[model samples]
Target: MTLQYIQDKEGKTTGVIIPIKEWQSLKEKYSELQEEVEPSTELMSWQKKILDERISDYFDDPENVGDFERTLDDIEKSL
Candidate 1:
């Protein structure tokens, strides 16, 4: 697992950064860490179609594809 640390000027580790998937996993393991917010698990049909297309694209060229963040940024830019 890759994590980034936010450090203070004196080099003290202030906080740790993790991927969203890992955060969700942590929330599942520890009840105390969970919040009241519950995100929807269901994807709309259009969302599912887009995901399927992206999965197909990924399988076609696994090495050349952008990571989720970059892809999301590109999408947001287009929007």
Candidate 2:
């Protein structure tokens, strides 16, 4: 993608100019650019219950829980 630069009278870059087509493509590829998105602020009851169950399970079998490296390695190997 070629970007055009806008310079001030002092020759310092003041802004950038992306082609409309490229800008539209970028907006499509990146969700944040597509709109003003709001993130979920609170967990619903079912979500909380699921997390509580997971926590209880962890406490019940602390030794069996996967560490970060092991979990990441398992994911990567699966992929």
Error of 2 at 53 (Å): 0.1
Candidate 2 lDDT, 1-79, residue by residue in tens: 9999999999999999999999889888998876654567789999999999999998999897768998999999999
Model 1 clash tally, residue pairs: 0
Can you write out model 1's per-residue Cα lDDT over 1-79, one digit (the tens) per residue? 7799999999999999999999889889987777555666889999999999999998998897668999899999999
With a 3 Å backbone cut-off (N, CA, C), the pairs that clash in candidate 1 are none
lDDT scores in order: 0.89, 0.90
What is the model-wide C-alpha lDDT for candidate 2? 0.90
TM-score, one value per model:
0.40, 0.45
Error of 1 at 32 (Å): 1.8
Measured by TM-score, the strongest candidate is 2
